[model samples]
Target: MQRVVSNLCNLLCSHYEITLISCYKANETLPATYNFPTNVKIIYFNEIYPDFKLDSFWDKVKFSYRINQLLPNGSKNILIVNNLLYPFFKKKNTIYIRLFHNSFENAYKKYLYKKPLFPPRIALFDKLIVLSSKELNHWQKLHKNIEVIPNFLPSIPKESSPLQSKIVLSVGRMDKGDQKGFFRLVDIWEIVQKDSRFGEWKLHIVGDGLLKEQIEEKIKAKNLQDSIILKPFTNQIEQEYLQASIYAMTSLFEGLPMVLVESASFGLPQISFDINTGPSDIIENEKSGFLIPDGDLEGYAEKLKALMQNQNLRESMGKRAKEIAQEKFSKEAILLKWQKMFNN
Candidate 1:
């Protein structure tokens, strides 16, 4: 989410007057990760409504009222949300856009159908942006104004970094239980560790969340403390990607995981479960990497073991992955898509 927002801010800042509004309080300690252009302005919801609690229905109403008051009362202004479906502002001048970062099935379950078939207020929006062609078709059934714009690779070294560490990398927030399928990776790692060919390789899990303690306990119970390393989130995450030999994801579902795109750009062979949406769009199965069936832990381990044992195969796949990322997901391509969307 940070990568997508930062990338847009960086790309559009020079061309447009961008104002970023966050729904939460700004972190005081950490400096801005992305260098925002001089024209970009950032505002936090907490700064505007300091006592507003997002969990409270009344507070949300008050926040919406406050937002309506602040925004210009004309159609010239554009309001883009990550995925949240807000109530219609009723002002004719403000255009509302919902940029979906997950599957339409999930978004429908979240916003449209609470009970029976409640009509979504989505008609209020001027446009909708989806991550894949599959999502575009699904959402087209519901609305006419939609476009497919895949996520782009963030700035990373184009050359393949020397694989100095025998490490398998997986990154995501641990708090998302079934969505991330992080616990499933712990089980898969245990199976991989049992194989002598992969005994020397270590699994590095990155990011922290509410489930961190539970994941730590599971690692201890499985006696994978040495083999499986859990690290907190870091700004220097690109270095972690460069050091690792392969990338792995066990997500149950995704829109289009930016991490996979970023990892592939660094020339890392990726192994991820073939879930509903994201991985299949990025990985060329058995070419750039392997995309095993969703929830097939044994198959995932076997493919991962194959990559671990064959250095030549890993390098070949990594090189192809880098080429695909560079050719298809360059910043220039993505920026053009967004510029067209805004202009249209």
Candidate 2:
């Protein structure tokens, strides 16, 4: 969420005066990670409602009401909301643009179906933004105003990462193990490690989460401590990408995954499950990477093993991956799309 906001702010700030409004507290400890333009102004809702609990329903309602009151009563001001909470603020004069960062199915569950309060409020928005054509199609069935704009690679690597190590990399927050399918990856790694063809290759899982201890336990139980490395989140993630030969994702579902885009920019051949939205959008099957059938652990292991054994195939796919990422998801191309949207 921060990446999308920061990237858009960085791109659009030159032409417009941008004000970023947040519902959370801005303290010294939780400093701004992104470098915002000098023209951009950031406003935190906690200043008005200091006791706001992000998880509490009543607090969210109060926050929404405050936000609605804060917005200028004129169409000249454009409001782009990158969260489900946009439905709560039904301002009359402003242009409300919703930037949905999840698959339509997930969005349906999170914003519309589960929370009955949102469907009617959803109609209040002027435009809805989706990540893929699949999501756009799905959302169009329910709403009239929608657009498809994919997430872009923030910056392409200057040169492709050399495939020197036999490493298969997977990155995501481990706290929500079910969502990211981290447990599933551990099981898949067990199968991959057992295969003689991939004996030397290691599975490197990156990012921290609530299930860190449980994940560690599973790795130890399987005696995969040596073969499977669990790494804490790091700012120097690009270095990790450069050292890896292959990228893997077992996510049950996703918004258009930024990790896949970053990995592809490094020219790493990817192998991911054919989830609802993301992997298919990024990877070209058997070209840039392999897309295994969803929940097909055996197939995933086999594909991983095949890639690990064949250096030539990995190199060829990695080259294609870099080319596709650069051509399709360049920052300039994506920024232009946003610029057009803003103009419209």
Task: Provide the global lDDT of candidate 1 against the true structure.
Answer: 0.81
lDDT of candidates 1 onward, in order = 0.81, 0.83
- TM-scores of all predicted structures: 0.85, 0.89
What is candidate 2's TM-score against the reference?
0.89
291-342: candidate 1 lDDT, tens digit per residue: 9998899999999999988888889999988887887788887888988988
Q: Number of clashing residue pairs in every model? A: 4, 2
lDDT of 2 at 43: 81
Error of 1 at 337 (Å): 0.6
User: After aligning candidate 1 to the native by TM-score, how far in Å is the CA of 226 from where it should be?
Assistant: 3.3
